[model samples]
Target: MKRKVLSIILAAALTGTMLAGCGSSAKQETPAVASDTGAPVSEQPAESSATQTGTSGKQTDGKNVPELTSEPLTITLWDISTEDPGKTTMEEAVQRFMADYPNITINQVHQQNDNYKQQLVVAMSSKQAPDMYIHWGGGPMAEYYKSGFVNDMTEMFNTYDHPDFIDAAVAQSTYDGKVLAIPFGGLSGCDIFYNKTIFAEVGVEVPETIDDLEAVCDKLIEAGYVPFALANGSKWTGSMYYMYLVARHSGNEEFDAAYTQEGSFTSDAFIWAGNKIQDWVKKGYFPDGVNSLSTDDGQDKALLYDNTCAMMLHGSWQVSGIRADNQEWYDENIGVFRFPEDSEAAAKGVPQDVEIGTAIGNGFSFNCWNADGSVDQTKLDACYVLATQYFNDDAYNQRRLDNGTIPSIKGFENTIDDANMKVVADIFFNASNVQLWYDQYLPASVTEVHKNCMTELFGLQKTPEEIGQEQDAAMKASLAE
Candidate 1:
């Protein structure tokens, strides 16, 4: 079944009192009264657990007893992506949690992604962050941790003996060598998805190098097809292409170095890559008016579904959505390819870079606790079981695979029915090196600047040199931070 986004709309008019009471924001104060006694202040638990089979597929050994003792415990938890008013999938998941442990009542709150970020900032400044809430780990989470908005869960994480993921996702969730939060899952980026039917129709073959790719694009154009469909208006969507080019041209090490080591965007690697992209744009390799494309408006999909564009480079998760939207097109015509090997560039044009699985999308970063920086031993114990168990659960792995999401867990394979998606999966699983999204590793504002500059370059509004200067300045500022 297609999992729909939760539609529950929360009132943005949040009060300081509500934020503290629900444990949904960072305004919570660890009070001395609550810490000293270690006695039950209220009768309710903050979070409830479910009695599902363990990751081993055996019945739980019954370690925790679900009893609602008269202890004053309030857990402020918030969830974004549960804004849908009709039927909340996560709420249903939370309900299952309630069923196992009837004593704990979650003071559950919901927010949209953008709004949640803004409000979370406020909660952090006010020192009232939720006992536990969903958060992105890298930048924002790091900032919040520095501000003392959330408690460290390192001990809790170690106690659980978290399983090793093939992609080493644990490291991404860690900050400055401290394991901050549990990673829910991660996305593998830059897999080339193509239409076999289009290839056959245009008599073009999938290329394996920069030159080969250019040759194929030229053939597709001569046959009256847009070589690729890129959505620049959505911003990040367009960065997918630029990142691939950079990784293929400059190589992962240097490209990554630029983010860490202060360097000019006009450096040899940057100029070479920027010039290549501008050249492609000038040649009309991408679809016309791509700058105005809306990610949600079906324009990008039309490029694929209507057979206007031949390929798209994105994370593997889109396979299920595309296949569900047009099964026939996916079944017969679609194919997947890795970024063609770039022998000339410093970073092997190869997609994977083992340093850290760099890719896009957010995942769980940290687990929170009650006010006064106290962990309800009972709840913490339950949470440990849930996180580690879910990480390796076969059913959970299967569900993600069914959605065309490639799991980094060792045994989880792509189970999508489409041959194209399966081929993509093989390339992903076998990739000797897998780097996470390049943009993901950058400071958010700088990544945005890169995206905007790439778009302007595509539109011929910015010269290659001009883009190099602006992007170099932005990266310099970010590095200073």
Candidate 2:
């Protein structure tokens, strides 16, 4: 419970990156693809409710879905969709599912984002694990699967009719060559959501390179605005900065090598990411006690709301959170922009366009087990129905779109009319590759190390080398096991 990373080997190889939790690297890289139509994933639909083929050769309609029991049953479903649009969207889905299946009831639990992984780890290690839960698929999900905390949904997925999810989303959800979880969360892209009014007032253009970004930060600071609204209490917020730095400095190859142990975390890119974060801290580019600001308490948004901060580099879901809280303010101020490229690095042939975020936002993996650890067949079928049928159906997706989410399914572009959402979708659509977050990508023990390192790195308590060395040590320990 002290950390999210557990130094143990999964039965299969590990894969993932920092998102909302901690973890190690993949033994093999999953190919990043877009839609089946080879179009940008952001241009994809949420759900068509049209006929589609399952992974297995068979296709299915509602009548062919495995029947649920008539006996009264209660199940718990956990996720970090604690805020609006996501929260309301999920609640509605569960309501619809239960309305149809009158004998079954789902207890949907919305956990705070900051403590979700740690709490889920504790739940799985004890008797309190939920029947089904949302997770950012990567090494930690692999850890959960290997530790017997989750069911292998491959067979169920293949047997059920699912939305034609983008190839990248499916690939991210699959682990060790099998479908371990369903991609219920939308295609998540992380970018800097800035106050357009601030830029206009400051007489600076949106940055297109790291250098330009720094210049903009300098001007923002001169204007007495915090350049970035960072609530590192969630840790993953800071991890985005580090991941983007690594991506721009050396592209995905460096992180990929570090993950596979083919290279070191002390690689130039990692070192650069660490030092750059520290430098930003010293430059007063961030707020005081940035790490102490709790994202769950809306502390970061508070900064944005008051105009104390001009920009927030965060997940696309913030569109909904911001819009839900103060629609007028969001419409008038907030705008989206991808993390700027490293122009100098690009000159050296280091591709600066690789994206850092999630193709699969959060995956839903079931844990339907009876006492003595035997599988609960009846509950598994019902849970799978909820996940595939209820969660990703047209109704569920329309709510997501209305809330401004672009799911990883093809053909839904017309539903998104928000200017901010359009920019985010375009970023995802144009990205050649998408990297999952490190906290979600690494194993438990390594994730703890990574998250802690981000805190220390941004706090300037540890040098980049020191942080990288610690991460490397954690990675080696996990790999050895």
Model 2 C-alpha lDDT per residue in residues 324-350, reported as the tens digit of each score = 899999999998889999998999998
Model 1: per-residue lDDT, tens digit, 411-451? 34423455665666566556555555544455455555777
Q: Which has the greatest lDDT?
A: 2
**Model 1 residue-pair collision total:** 40
Q: After superposition, how far is residue 102 of candidate 1 from its true place, in Å?
A: 2.4
- What C-alpha lDDT, on a 0 to 100 scale, does residue 435 get in candidate 1? 53
lDDT of 2: 0.77
Q: Where does candidate 2 stray beyond 4 Å?
A: 1-64, 71-74, 81-85, 126-128, 369-376
- By summed lDDT, the worst window of 10 consecutive residues in model 1 runs over 14-23
Hey, what RMSD does candidate 1 come out at? 11.4
